[model samples]
Target: MLSFTPYENPTYFGILAIALLPIVIGLLCKKRFHWYETIISIFFLVLTFGGPKLTQGYALIAYLIYEVVLVWLYTSYRKHKNQTSIFVGAVILAIIPLVIVKLTPAIQNGQQSLIGFLGISYLTFKAVQTIMESRDGVLKAFNPWFFLQFLVFFPTISSGPIDRYRRFKKDYDHVPDTDKYLQLLQKGVHNIFMGFVYKYMLAYLFGTLLLPKLQQQALSAHGLSWSLVGVMYVYSMYLFFDFAGYSLFAVGTSYFMGIETPINFNAPFKSHNIKEFWNRWHMTLSFWFRDYIYMRLVFFFMKHKVFKSPKTTANITYIINMTIMGFWHGVTWYYVTYGILHGIALVVNDWWLRYKKKHQKQIPHNKFTEIFAVFVTFNFVCFTFLLFSGFLNTMLLAK
Candidate 1:
């Protein structure tokens, strides 16, 4: 059987273009062929999760059934009764599979969990968010069919810009007019072209062609060499372009389907501070963490009077939140350290902002200062990427 991961290469896009042509034409005619859309979705899902990856496909199906039932039951319960413990239980149940997947590697000597599938993490985020919003009364109705469509939305099924239930429902339920769809088509084309350059060209150069040579040199040189620095910058570029390119393709495809999915990147390398960097880089994930984890933690701490000062509460929460995020990437020491480093950076960034506000006259604010800030932030971030890359463990610890 022939199969291709979503947006894996130009060939995949060519296949996608043919598959999406009817949907695009339907949208241009001010129509949404729901049946056709669902058909293509299944087709693409099969392409991504089927064939040799059949185990993952089965896992995805089982996970979807599990999550859908969980969400439906939670929504039903939330309608008449709102119990904190029950809500917490529901959230825990929803995340249990993902937790198992993340922990399995460490416990089983790097073995993958059977329940794991591509985008399980992303799916869990969506499911948990849905449950959370249902508890908050933001999501009033939970249609199981629509929920399934949202969950299995093919473009972002493998990875996501992580669409919200309400936002996605709004787009999915409406068909844009011809003029509006024309604009969407224009932006979609532009995004796809840009993605080709970023993913196929630049990412290929940095990740495939250059990174191997740099990695070999860095490994040979071992600790604290110029080659390691080269690895850091090259890997950073590769990570950004590859991920940003994937995001663009996903979002662009969503537009072609007449849904304006959220963007995931915005000139992240140009950010001047760690806080600002989070806002620009992998924006959906950062925003999700802010809204769901960080904000909720702050509220919980404040409600319980856990800390004497707001600053202390925020600083602590920042570390805990980022550490959890790191652990989400994997249950590895490198990932955990990467998260801790970012957490500390965020805390320091907050403190510096406060100090600068109080001593505006003393602290210089000019073009040079701005450039220097960007320079410092970019290097700091790239260094963290080096830790995140696991090259250090390979070089220093491996036999």
Candidate 2:
């Protein structure tokens, strides 16, 4: 399995060095590195690290072919207006395999998962979103190379901020200024270090030591009350660090290339409510669901309601949409549970919001109260992650 291990692999370091050479050369030649140039270098770096995973390799090849076909489809649509819906249909058809592979578990187990590829989910979403946007007239121009660059952009590919097509277009159109390049280089260096600290130090400590110890003790005691709670805390923190670290690297790299991809995380643990957490954490993905998935589902459900229901009906639809979004994160019963749990939390949060709006004098607004809300929200998120973690499988199966 490909790990989120930082810098322990010499091959990765070498690849990073190789990617940097272009930037150095670009600077020396007085040619500011374009976003596409940085993208190419990053692709080389990731390909070098990819080494030899059969399914992953095949998936990448498949993705490359898919990108070409998508570009052709886009071009054909632009050339002949009559074929626009055909292009949309083709893009939807393209996502079938990804959906199947993700929803089917047999392919991700035993020796199969070893070759099953890392970040297929992330890549699939990026491709689908891009195609959907292109069909919606969000992307006015299409460059095959640029499309491929966005499709397989290395740093964010594994775990993404889920860059939007319009934003990407705008960023790519602008070239990097020299001073800005220096700033990005500084930020990239800092992010690389922080990624190491998060993955190697914090996550490693918990994953290798604290978690294992707790799991063993929990099993030995034949009870999981306390251990499960501790495991939840540790795993949640690990997830935040692991994913946030990757996002930082991605944004920093894009910055170096003069493409300012939107930020993914914003100290999500500090969020005072489930809605706030969703807003701050995985900001891009949340917006993706909000724009592409949630609001549409809400409107559709509202339009087709059994009665002319109140705002509550619309809110229920939002919860259902978010539940589905959570389910999209993985293909397991635990993921389903996680989704449902989050949906409930969001519903309750909405209720609270409405209550506070109606009775402004009721809710506490003290620092301690704010801190408590943040604490509760953070733990709620943590517990869901614990349930989703593979450790819960042993207990469930034993029953």
Candidate 3:
């Protein structure tokens, strides 16, 4: 019995390749061996959570059972009755495990919760959204088995491009045409190879090789210095590559199974503003927040006259939504600050956009401005990543 993190090393990918071969072949031949797919998925789950990580395995199992049944019950109830209180209760219950997991570390001086396991947050996201959609009458026909598959879709299970229930079901229920399947295969191979460069090569170069040195240098500086700047830039690169690389692997693996999982990142560093950065980076998660949280909050605010102006409503929701996202990352002060700053950036960016649009005749819209915008956004993001990294906390402690 052995345990491994998803996409952690060469050996895991090797096993993955062997396992995916059957799926690739089946898709090529216009066949889907779902039974086989389930078996391999379970096998990979074991490799990830079994052996020394068996406690996590148990937690995952119990968590899945609770969520699946909870969704089932909600779907059952939603079919006939739609009570807002019930829906809210269900959503809260779905997130309770994740909340406890997050709070345990902060409350208990960094002791991990017994019920916590890798990807709990992601799983909770899936479950809560399912409930939300169910309440909205969007996800009418809820298949418990398929829902379970989507939640445990081992490829994007741990960290996600956060596929929706309806979207996933559409892909799962259909077989792509020959040409499309071939294209998917080609892209899948390309994505996996690209992931190797991102996660293994460049991330290693930045995070493993460069980040530690920069971190040590920055820490010893006892104050802001060039070393801190180096740490900021190197860490920003490392964070992007590490996550973008994982996203590539998850999406590429999904492609092999003919599932067409949504991508998580674009050229995020090229974004000209914080809003655009979010749209380009972690596309799925941000979109989820937009659809499920921000949009809903805005609608509620507007509906109930919570704010006099629609713009004000949006600005307030942006802060609330992103702050929750930050807390979702962790309970630490740095994480919360990271979210709050992004929220403020979004508000400011929106204001600037509105002002620029009104003064379009006076405002110079040119190539240079675009480039300058990119520079500003990238550097601002890097500085925020410095906060997100918790190195500033270390600096404060050193002081």
Model 1 residue runs over 4 Å out of place are none
lDDT of each: 0.94, 0.70, 0.94
lDDT of 1 at 230: 95
lDDT of 3 by residue, 1-399 (tens): 989999997899999999999988888899988899999999999999999999999999999999999999999999999998999999999999999999999999999999999899888999999999999888879989999999999998888879999999899888899999999999999999999999999999999999999888888889989999999999999999999999999999999999999999999999999999999999999999999999999989999998999999999999999999999999999999999999999999999999999999999999999999999999999999999999999899988
Worst window of 10 by summed lDDT in candidate 1: 390-399
How much does candidate 3 score in TM-score? 0.99
lDDT of 1 by residue, 1-399 (tens): 777888986678888999899999888887899999899999988888878999998999999999999999999999999999999999999999999999999999999999999999999999999999999998988999999999999998877999999999999999999999999999999999899899999999999999999999887776678998899999999999999999999999999999999999999999999999999999999999999999999999999999999999999999999999999999999999999999999999999999999999999999999999999999999999999999988997744
Better of 1 and 2 by lDDT: 1
**Residue runs of model 2 more than 4 Å from their true location after superposition:** 1-11, 24-50, 78-88, 106-116, 302-307
- TM-score-wise, the better of 2 and 3 is 3
Which scores greater on TM-score, model 1 or model 2? 1
Task: Give a tens-digit lDDT track for model 2, residues 126-157.
Answer: 66676666666666676777777676666566
Candidate order by TM-score, decreasing, is 3, 1, 2
lDDT for model 3, on a 0 to 1 scale? 0.94
Off by over 4 Å in 3: none
